[model samples]
Target: MQPNAESVVVLDFETTGLSPDQGDRAIEIGAVRLQNGVITERFQQLMDPGRRISPFIEEYTGITNAMLADAAPVSQVMAEFADFIGDDNLVAHNASFDKRFLDAEFARISRSYPGEFACSLLVSRRLYQDCPNHKLGTLVRWKNITGEGSFHRALYDAEMTAYLWLAMLADIREQSQLELVPFELVTELSKTAKKSVGAFFSRW
Candidate 1:
């Protein structure tokens, strides 16, 4: 499916750790707004997760607890971010992971976030299956896309994801016959697959 102009918000989050439901929280959120394949604007913030930064997470993201001591709370950042997203489709590498953190943050503030989401990881698997490694770093290098900052930072990774998403779209167009499906349909199929897998496990 071809993405419409200004229809996508490519986003990423830097969190204290994985599993937002387990008390982890987003320490930073970043996103790039895209209109017709061009990035029109960006949003980024360091969030006060209201917890101590773990040494492992700090070493990974280079964001210390002290750095976020005065940062805005997740509620405020998410509010501003929700405004930026504005009902547009969202994109991320490993999107469900990021969405879990975002939804958890929103839940904490008693707000709801509902929108269409896309995963660049799935797109990469669909379009570049020959590549042995589908990690963001590996895919970025394989696609010859240059990332400005280190990995794990929200904005930098989001920027790279945006580029990678565009490139994957191009690759899919070049290689596939499924050219006319709507973006919404692609997203729905992905979500359905995830739910089917989850339901299977729950029943097991």
Candidate 2:
């Protein structure tokens, strides 16, 4: 059986750099657990990557090296994060980026998650084609979703992404005239051709 959008955890990561392969590490992770479409729990942590973050990264994410200097180590943070994740499915905007870091960090602790991941960015691209773009902030403005008036921070981005994910699920249900929108259908929508999206819905 497929999970509902209401029951997944929405997560975001702020990292030292783009790829883990390049020795980049996640300095922070923020996530919210949704139950029946309401946020029931939250998790946020900043970890010491054991290296000074670049000036550009510091400016871009507003996460200073000093802020991370006293934080817990990566292994401790990831182990706690793993407990927070438990068995829920995951959602993230631009999930590929977050997923890479998540997998890399989990590997450090020899941990793994069984839940599937869904990309709000990909699903939004297919669902909101008329929108100028599908970036998390842009979608918040387009959909009139309330935001905390900040971006690039881990928890705030996860919060916005969570709202955006819910909006897309609502759009799908309203447009398809279906009462329930399965997580499987949302993932499928991400892969459906743009021109054939309407036809794809009919098949459901």
Candidate 3:
């Protein structure tokens, strides 16, 4: 049988700003590895981005400049993260943002992952179109997923995204009546158009 929610990494990043091209950098990263629909391992680290973060970012993520003062350098952290990844497929709430930073940071360390990324946000949008919005927090509430802690912090957000991913997988399996939902199916569903979503599932 193909791997379902049994093996993958859900990741989140706290960044200094939006775009790396605009000199932004990831200040922290959090990821959790799932096996058999449960998290079996975790990776979290705060990196020193070698510059002062904007007051807004500091306020937003609650990762102060003071906290980053003595943290490991981005290159060092990225190298360790590359090892932690180790060919695992990745998931993120809004994956493009995290993927961009992952790529940028990997480039700095001359490292890359062969695994693909699946965005929980995209899959949720298709599965839960009636949701008020697709933001991580919104979906957590909309699905009644157990949300015990805070958001914005890399580890906390990654944890929440992990649970949300599991919830979506369960829903898809129950609704689609499939014994297993492959990573490829989730990736394909993310690309399926809204209007064609029902047809997409029907054909599956």
Candidate 2 lDDT by residue in tens digits, 1-204? 667767999999999999999999999999999888899999999999989999999999999988998999988999999999999999999999999999999998999999999999999999988999888889999999886646999999999999998888888998788787888889889999999999988888
Residue clash pairs of candidate 1 = 5-36, 6-35
For candidate 3, the per-residue lDDT at 181 reads 88
Question: Which 10 consecutive positions of candidate 2 have the poorest summed lDDT?
Answer: 145-154
- Off-target runs (Cα >4 Å) in candidate 2 are none
Clashes of each: 2, 0, 0
Estimate TM-scores for all models: 0.85, 0.97, 0.97
Local error of candidate 1 at residue 8 (angstroms): 0.2
Better of 1 and 2 by lDDT: 2
Per residue, candidate 1 scores C-alpha lDDT tens digits across 56-95 of 9999999988889999988899888878888788889999
Q: Whole-model lDDT for model 1 versus the true structure?
A: 0.79
- Please rank every candidate by lDDT, starting with the best: 2, 3, 1
All candidates in order of TM-score, best leading = 2, 3, 1
Estimate, for each residue in 137-188, the C-alpha lDDT of model 3 and write its tens digit.
Answer: 9998887877566799999999999999998999888777888889988999
